[model samples]
Target: MDENRKIIQVLIAICSLFFIIVGYLTYIQLFRSRDFMANTYNRRQYKIEENTSRGNIYDRNGVLLAYSKLEGEEQERIYPYGALYSQVIGYSSKVYGKSQIEAAYNNELLGIDDLSQVFGMVSGSNYPTRKGNNLYLTIDHKLQALGGELLNGRKGAVVAMDPKTGEILALVSSPNFDPGAKKLEENWQSMVESEDAPFLCRAAQGLYAPGSTFKILITAAAIENGMENEVFEDNGSIIIDEREIRNSESKAYGKIDLKKALALSSNVVYAHLGTELGMGSFMDITNRTGFEKEIPFDIPMSKSRFPYESMDKTDLAEAAIGQGKVLVTPLHMAMITSGVANGGIMMEPVLVKSIAHAEGKSNKELKADKLGRIMESDVAEKIRVMMQEVVASGTGHNAAIKGISVAGKTGTAENELSVKKKAKEHSWFVGFAPAEDPKIAVAVIVEYGGSGSEAAVPIAKRIMSQYLSQ
Candidate 1:
C-alpha cells in the first residue's frame, strides 16, 4: 500500500512538471516576447511630429532618394516625391506611422537608441527621439530613376544588382503611385481601395512565372549533373513520352550542340535535358541556388517555389523550358544572375550599405554573405560560355553592350492563368555586364510585354550605360 502511494505521488509530480513546462513555453513563445519588445501605447504617445524633418535617404554616391519638408506655418512634414521611394523609404505620416526602411531603421533614425544626453539643448527632453538616421543605400539613384522611366505606366518590375558584391542598384515597379497624388486625391478612400495596389512594391513583392529565363537555372543543372560527352543535338523537335516538344516559333535547327541549344533558347532540347536529369535532379539544382526557401535579407522578399510531385511527360518537357509550375520574383532572378556571375556562388542580396549612429558615427557596415556555391567551377564556366553565346549570336543579341562583353538570356513566358486564350506573355531578361569580370547583374520582367529582347533588353542597356558611366 505504501509503495502504491509513492508511485501515485511520483506520477502527480511528473504531471505537474509537464504542465508547468508547457505553460512556460507557451508564455515565452506567444506573450512574453511581445510584451518586452513591443510597447504600442508608448510608441503612439511619443510619435515623431510631422513638422520635424524625417531623416533623409541617400544612395551610395550621396544622391537623395527621399527627403521631408515642413509645411508653411504648420510644422507638418510633406513628401515631395511621394511614391517615388515609398517602398525603400516608407511613408512617415502621422496617420500611417512608418514602413520599409522607415520602420526597419526607426530606432537609429529617431535616436531612440541614444537616450537624450544632459548637455543636449533644445526642449531638453530625456528620451529625445532624435531625428531619423540618415541612410546611405547601395542603390544607384541614376539607375533606379532610369529603370523607373523604362517601366513607366506598365505593370511589372525591374531589379539590378552588382553581381560581384551583391549590391542592389535599381529596384523599380510600375503602376507606381505619385506619392504626392495620394494626398490630393479627395477620394483617397477609393484610391487606396483600387485593385492596382500601388502601395505595394511589385519589384520586391510580386511573384510571377519566370518563363524561359528559368532555363538558365536548368542549363546550370544539366551541366552540373554530367554532360561530358552528351550533346543536345537540335533537330528542331524532341519527342518525350510520345509528346512532341518544338522550339519557339517551331523553328528548325539541324544537329546543333547543347551550347547552341541554350543560345537559341530551345524548348525541345531542354525538355530532353530535363527528362534526362529527372525531377529529383532539377530540385537538387534549385535547392543549391536558394530556391524553395526563404533567404535572409533586410528587405521583405518573396520565396521561390517549385511544387510538383510527378508531372505529365509533356509538362516535364515544358517545365524544363521554364514554362510550367515555376514562379519567381525579380529579386530572385537577380540572385540567379549573380550566381552565374560570381562563379556559381550565390551571395545574399544587400540593400543597406551601413548603419550610422545618432552622434554622426557609423555603426556596423553590412557585408555580403555567401549563401552557398551552386555548381562546380567547371560547370559554371560551361554555363557562362553558353550565356555569352546567347548574347553574341542568339536571341539575346539585343543585350550586347560594346566593350563590355555582356552575357544574357531572354524569356517570353506565357501566362498559364489565361491558358485557353492566346496567352499574354511576360517579357524577361537576366544578364550581367562586363561578363569577363561581372560588375552588374540585372533582371527585368514586363507583364503582357511582347518579347523579352524587344521589351526588356533596352531598359537594361540604359541602366548598364548609366552605371558604367558613373
Candidate 2:
C-alpha cells in the first residue's frame, strides 16, 4: 500500500513540471517574441535580412533615398544620394548595427507583422520574402541638397521648417559620410576617429551657445511679465556684480525700448533686462520653450540645457544674452523662431510624412501636432515686428530678401576652440520670411564662422529664398 502511494506522488510531481515548462514556453511565444526579434545583438535579424527585402526610403516628392537589392542570395542596402541624407536615413549593417530612422522604425521597415511572426514561431516556417513598408519623409530633396551645398563641407548645420505646421523642410549637417562608401568597413575606424565627427548629427544633436538669438525668448519673458515698454540706457556696456558686459564694438545706444534693443542686438540692454527679469522668470520661459527637456523628434535629439539651479546677478546677466551655460540645438532654435512666426503656438517637429505598405496601400500618414503656446498672440506679434526691424535696418541686414519682408536676428556666440589660439565666434541666424504671413523659418549656425552678418545670415537668406521661390 505504501509503495503504491509513493508511485502516485511521483507521477503528480512529473505532471506539474511538464505543465510549468509548457506555460513558460507559451508566454515567451506570445509576449517576449517581439523583444527578442528587435534586439540588435540578436542573430535572428541577419536571418530576417536574408529572407525579407527591406523597405525603400523616399523624399517628399518620391525621390528614392535608400533601397535594398538582392546580390546573389544576399541583400545589399543602397543610398542613392550618398552623404546628402546620411545623418537622417542612417545605415543598417550587420557588423556595425543601425542608427537614426533605420533603428527607430526597424520593425516597420522589416515588415514583421505580429500575426505572421506568431505563425512563423508556432509553425517553424521560413520568414516571408515580402518587401517592407515604404517611408516618405517630409524632407525636400532640393532644399536638402541646397543646404548641404551652402555648408560646403564646413562644420555646421542648417534647419528649415514650415512655421505653422512644423514640417521640417531641410535638415543638413555638414562633414557627412557616405553610408554606402566602398570599403566602408575599412574606413569606419578613421571616420569614427576624425575630429570633424562625420557621425554627429549637428542639426539635432549639436548644442551651442545661442548668443543673441536667445534674446527672443528673453524679450518674450519681459513682455509676459509686463516690462515690454520698459526703457534702458545702453552705453555699450553694463556692470553686473562688477562684471562688465559690452555690445559688439562697444557701440552705445541712448535710452531705448525693448523693440530697438533687440533690433540693435544690444548686449548691455539685454544683460540689464536679464538681471531685472530674475532667474525664476527666465527659467519659466525657457521651460515653456522646450529647454532642459528632451524634445520629441522622429530621431534622437539632445536636450537644450539651461541652468536649473539658482543663479547670481552676473550669471543671470550673461544667461539673458544667450551666454553663460545656456545651450540650444539648431533645430530647437528653428522651432522657437517658428513658434513666434506661428503666433506663439509652437508645433511639434515632424520628419516622416507617410508610410506605404509593400502591397501599395497607404498604412499611416503623420500630421501636424501642437507642442504648446509659448506666449500670448499679441506678444508674439510685437516680437514679430521687432524681428522685421532687425532685417530692415538692424544687424541682420544681410538676410534681407528681394521683394520679401524678412524677419530675423543675428548671433555671434563666443566659443573656445583651443587654449593657445583666439577662437572665431560661432555665427548664428534665426528668421522667417514674409513676416506678416510666414511660410518658411530657418536657423543656421556656422562653427568658427565669425560674424552672424557674414556667415550665418547669408546662408539663412539663401535657404529661405530657395524654399519660398518654389
Candidate 3:
C-alpha cells in the first residue's frame, strides 16, 4: 500500500507539471506573443518552428521582398533586397524574433486562421502545407529603394503616402541592419548599441520637436478659425506673456499678411498668433487633426502629442511654432500633410494591400477608410496656397520638383536637450506634390541634420521625383 501511494504521488506531480507548462504556452500564444516564430522557450517548439512554413512577402508590384525556403529539415528565410525593406517588411527569424508586418499578421501567414486548413491537418491530410500564404504590401519597391538611397548614411527617416488613397508608398529609416546577413546576432548587437538606433522605426516611433514645419498646423488653425485675412507685421520679434520670440535669425519683414508670414515662416507672427488664438481654440483644431491620439494603422504607431494642459501663455506661444513640448513622429507629420492634401479628410493609413492563400483561393483586398474630416475645405485650400508659396519662393524652395507645383514647409528643429547639443539640429520638410490634384504627401526628418532645405528637402525632392515620375 505504501509503494502504491508513492506511485500515485509521482503521477500527480507529473500531471501538475504538464498543466503548468501548457498554461504558460497558452498565455504566450494567445496573449503575450502571436505565432510560434518568436517563442523559443522550449527545444521541441524551436525544432517545430525551424521546420514550419511561412508566407511570402512582396511589394505592390509583386517584387519579392521576403520568402521562405526548405533546406533539408530546417527552414531558411530569404530577403532578396537585403537592407532596403529591412524595417518595413521586417524579418521572420528564429534567432531575432519578429517585428512590423511579420509579427503583426503572423497567423495569416501560418494558415492557422483558415478553418479549412486546420481541419485538413486534423483529418489525416496526406499533402503538406509548407508554403502558407502570401502578403502583398502597398509599398512600391522602386520608391522604397529611392527612399533608402536618399537617406544614404544620414540618421533620419522618410515617409510617403498617397493623399487620396492613404496608401503608404514608401517608408525608410536610416542606420539599418540586414537581418539576412551572416553573423546576424553580432550585427543586431552592434545595431542595438549604435547611437542612431537602427532598430527604431524612425518614421513611426522616433519623436522629435517639429520646428517650423509645425507652422503649417498653426496656419491651418488660424485659417479655420476665421483668421485668414488677419494681417500682422514682423518686426523681427514679438513679446508674448513677457517672453520675447524672434523670427528665424531675427531678420523679419516690416509688414506682411498671413500668407506672407507662413511663406516666410515668421516665428514672431506665429508666436503672436498662438497667444491670440489661445489654448481653447488650439486644442479644438489640433484634436480634430488627430493630435495626442493613437493613429490607427496596419502596424504599430506611436502617438503624436500636443501638450495643452498646464501650458502657460509662453508655453502656448512656443507650441504654436512646433516647439516647446510639441512632439511628433515622421509618420504623424506625413498624415497631417496627407490630410491637407485630401481636402481636410484624414484617411486611415494602410500598408498591407492584400493577402493571398497558397491554396489558390481568392485574394483578400483591404479597402481605404476615412478616419475623419479634420479641417474645413476652404481652410485647407487657403493653407495650401500658403504652403505652395513656401516651396515656390520661400524656405522650402529646395523641395520644389521641376514643373510639379509642390507645396511644402521647411523646419530647422532646435535640439537643445541632447547631450551633444552642437552635433546638429533635426531638419524637417512636409509637403504634397501636384498641388492642383494632390497625389503624394511626404515627410522627411534628418536627425542632427542642418537646415530643412539642406538636409531634408533634397531627400524629399528625390523621393517625389521618383514616385511622381513613375
Between 1 and 2, whose TM-score is larger? 2
Please give, for residues 1-470, the per-residue lDDT of candidate 1 as tens digits: 99999999999999999999999988865665434322334442243332123466678887776665544533343444556666666565445555677666655554443123222223433232346567778988778778878888788888999877888888888766644423635445665898877767777788778777888888877776766346656777888888787777788776667788878888878888788778787778878877779987766777887877776677768788877788788898989888888898888888888766534477768878888888877777777888899999999998888878888899888785446556567889998878888888899988888678878888877777678877
Question: Using TM-score as the measure, what is the rank order of every candidate, best first?
Answer: 2, 3, 1
- Candidates' C-alpha lDDT: 0.74, 0.89, 0.82
lDDT of 2 at 4: 96
**Cα-based lDDT at residue 82, candidate 2:** 89
Give candidate 3 misplaced runs (Cα > 4 Å). 1-52, 114-128, 359-362, 417-421
Clashing pairs in 2: none
RMSD to native, candidate 2: 3.7
Total residue pair clashes for candidate 2? 0
Q: Which stretches of candidate 1 lie over 4 Å from their true place?
A: 1-45, 48-53, 72-80, 114-129, 180-188, 242-244, 358-360, 416-418
Q: Assess every candidate by TM-score.
A: 0.85, 0.91, 0.87
TM-score of model 1 vs. true structure = 0.85
After aligning candidate 3 to the native by TM-score, how far in Å is the CA of 359 from where it should be?
6.1
